[model samples]
Target: MISYCVFDAYGTLFDVHSAASKFQRILGNKQESVSALWRQKQLEYTWLRSLMGRYVSFDQVTADALQYSLQVHGFQEDSSKVNLLEAYKKLDCYEDVQSCLNQLRANNVATAILSNGTLPSLKTLVENANVAHLFDQLISVSEVEVYKPHPSAYDLVTRKAQIPKEKVAFISSNCWDAIGAANFGFQVFWLNRNENVPDVLPGKFTTIYNLNQLLDKVVQPS
Candidate 1:
């Protein structure tokens, strides 16, 4: 039985691509590519920084990724970068987020957001989406000066909640994240919204198409 439900904030609860989507007027046909590269670079930078023992806030990493995307795509305007970054601060939550969280809360499940995000950005994101009150805690890897997939990053949950890893259900849209949590001993759920093939990682995790399935999986027995 799971006592706490921990979720990844960026792609799990919020739509990270929505930042670039908001600038469709300028990006036109380039929006998807831009968003993809930005996200790819963002994750790369996090892992790179973590390994190098050089830590920076997610905000800085996000800005750096956006800048790289803009440059690669030939978007020379600083205003374009500013607009995307500003839009990112208030990323729209996924459609199923509120309902799923509400159901979990109604069931008396302890809920938290465990992310690579900085605390301020996480707070602003949930608050802007009007779902701030739904979470019991908004946890950030920034607290440990590292990013996800690191053992220390996963340890934050155990430290804060005082729950055994076996009794926590960790959810993430990213396969690596789910793998990391599972390796750390949480019963992990991967929200496979993109229908991508599962990674060849060693840890076990359940994959679901949407939050509705996720809610059913976590709240009900296997």
Candidate 2:
């Protein structure tokens, strides 16, 4: 039986697109492209930094990713970049988040967030979304000095909750992150919100279309 439900913050619990969506007036037609590229670069930087043994905080990675996106899109890097980062600090929570979290809490299952986001950023995010009370913990990869897809990053859940990986059901919308948690021995649940194709990563995981489906797939103790 699962004792803890550890969720990934960005893209899973929080809508990363909300950052770009907030500035649609300024971005015009390039809003979606800019948001997609920013996220892609953010994930790439984390993996690259981890492999190179040069760890940086997610804050730095986020800024660099935004800068890269601005450059590639030929957008002005003046006030636009600043505005975008500010918008990202308080990303909107997904529609299904509250009901799912409420269900987990009602079932007496511990819930915590596992994210590449920094502590301050995560705090600002959940608080802004008014879902801060739902989590028993807000874990960041900052604790381990690396980002997700790394074993050490996944190890944070075990350390914080003091539970065996098997008893913790890990949830993430990112395919790579779900694969990482699965490889680390958590009962992995991939919130495939986008209906995208799954990665060929070598780890076992269950895919769900939404967060509400989680309780049905992951059984609670009697």
Candidate 3:
């Protein structure tokens, strides 16, 4: 039986696109999509930095991505504007994420958030969402200075959760993350909210449409 559920934070628990929307609306001019570009660059920089061993906290990486995204997208730099754009760090949860989390918690199953987010951002998110008390643990890859898709990150989770991988069902909206955790021996569940094709990875896997599907899969009988 899966007694523990581990989740990813950004695109998984929180809508990461909120930051870009705030940016675009604030800037008030863009022939281009600032949100998309910022998100793309943030992921790109994360992977590149992780591979290069030039690790910074997720908050720093996000700021750097935003600054460069501004230059590339032709948005003028205003310190206040840049700080507001970093509002992704303060982004709230999706429509009823607390309900899903509460469902798991009420069942006596342990739940955690495993993400690349830094302390300040994750703290604000849990507090603002009023779901901080629901989480048994909040694990961050920032602790290990490596991003997701790296086995060590998942290992950090397994170590921290103190639960064997098989008993913990790992859930990620990112297909690659589900793949990574599976390879690391967790019972991985993919939340394919985007309806996109599953990218190839080491572990063969199963998917669900959203948290409800995941609940059906794990909480319901096998």
Candidate 4:
């Protein structure tokens, strides 16, 4: 069994869909496609801008994405939408997360979140989730001036936890995360709660639907 578990914050742990959910209340059904597109573009900008050596914070990227998604989706100009989406950092965790994290604590496995978000955003999530104490640490990818899939951000886990990559179980709701961590030689886990397409890439990994499944798979012996 792995001794440490690393998680992605926004989409993986905290309900990243909250941004969309909040928008639905403001713009109704029309907001769905916009929010989704914003999220996609946000990720794209973060990756592309990174490659161009034009470093920007995730919050900036998010605003850039919102602008692009709005223009593409033909939405009216509203700067508030970006701020509204930013409000997602205040979102809570999935219903199952608290109990599931507690289970890992009982097993003495180290748990933490590795995100492209800023330190302030991660702090808000940990506090809103009321599980800050449950984690061994909270790391922002900005520490390396690059995001996940870069390996350096993931390597940050080692600085504090002081463990081998194989001993670390990487859990991500994002397929890209699975592919990246897998390629980096860590034991990856796909927390496929969204039921999206799986990563075709290969690596040392396990795929599970829910956190409770770990009871039989990791916590308890066969």
Candidate 4 lDDT over 1-222, as tens digits, reads: 688878888777787667666666555676777767878888888788778878788877877787777778666658656556667677758787888889887888888888899988788878877988888788888888887677787888887688888788888888888888888877878888877778676665677888776555556552
- Candidate 2 residue pairs in clash (backbone atoms < 3 Å): none
Tens digits of per-residue lDDT, candidate 1, 1-222, equal 777999999999999999999899999999999999999999999999999999999999999998999999999859998899999999989999989999988887889999999999999999899999999998999989989899999999999998888889999999999999988999999999999999998999999889988777778643
Global lDDT of each candidate: 0.92, 0.91, 0.80, 0.78
Listed in order, each prediction's TM-score against the native is: 0.97, 0.97, 0.91, 0.92
Please estimate how well model 1 matches the true structure, expressed as its whole-model Cα lDDT.
0.92
Which has the higher TM-score value, candidate number 2 or candidate number 3? Answer: 2
Per-candidate Cα RMSD to the true structure, in Å, reads 1.4, 1.1, 2.1, 1.9
Model 4 CA deviation exceeding 4 Å by range: 220-222
**Candidate 3: minimum summed lDDT over ten consecutive residues — where?**
23-32
Model 2 lDDT per residue over 108-214, tens place: 89999999999999999999999999999999989889878889988988987789888999999999889999999999989999899999879999999999899
lDDT of 3: 0.80
Candidate 1: residue 95 Cα off by (Å): 0.9
Task: Determine which window of 10 residues in candidate 2 has minimal summed lDDT.
Answer: 213-222
Comparing candidate 1 with candidate 4, which one achieves the higher TM-score? 1
- lDDT string for model 3 (182-215, tens) is 8888888888888989986678577887787777
From the highest lDDT down, the ranking of the candidates is 1, 2, 3, 4
On a 0 to 100 scale, what is the lDDT of residue 204 in model 2? 94
For each predicted model, how many residue pairs clash, with residues at least 3 apart or on different chains? 0, 0, 0, 0
After superposition, the stretches of candidate 2 with alpha carbons farther than 4 Å from their true spots are 219-222
Give residue 108's error in model 1 in angstroms.
1.1
